[model samples]
Target: MRGLDDHTYRKRTAALKAKRHDCWLCGDPIDYTLPWKHKMAFTADHIQPRSKGGHIYGEIRAAHRSCNSSRSNRVTTVTTAPKTALRW
Candidate 1:
């Protein structure tokens, strides 16, 4: 994520809080009131990350904070290349 100003961050946070506490990616409920140590804490995530030209507020999603942080901006590869495939 880019260096967001405090005001921007707070504004975004407020908007997110008003939305339903559900994981936008998977449609799972996010228990924000629960303690983080209990593995049920909620977090705001960008559907498309800022590094990939995603708008912070326009494409936001709720997720387990840990899940969001762990995903970071790595592209997910579902299929592995064959070991014998020639190099490009």
Candidate 2:
């Protein structure tokens, strides 16, 4: 599915940062100052999987990129890969 545009992404991310949101996965604070590619960067996450028709900000929360990737498309607890602790 298509994701939020850059403009919308920026606006929404900024708003969450303004609210000082913490990572929904690990209870860590989101560092909005970091770029999205950073492991600790703030990302918009769906409480439900988007592939299951979830919408941004519908059931969304802020998460770290690593945290979100680690949680992708599942309701399972976050797990670390043996080598990297990341799915990638």
Where does candidate 1 clash, by residue pair? none
**Winning candidate number (lDDT):** 2
lDDT of 1: 0.65
Write model 1 residue lDDT over 2-87, tens digit each, in one string.
55665687678767867756765445678877775655577767766778886656556567776776778854332543233377
Per-residue accuracy of model 2 over 4-62 as CA lDDT, tens digit each = 56567567767766786778788767778898799999887877787777655455678
After superposition, the stretches of candidate 2 with alpha carbons farther than 4 Å from their true spots are 1-10, 76-88
Clashes of each: 0, 1
Cα TM-score per model: 0.58, 0.66
Least accurate stretch of 10 residues (summed lDDT) in model 1?
76-85
In model 1, how large is the Cα lDDT of residue 35?
Answer: 74
Task: Quote the positional error of residue 17 for candidate 1 in Å.
Answer: 1.3
- CA lDDT, every model vs. true structure: 0.65, 0.74
Q: Pick the TM-score winner.
A: 2
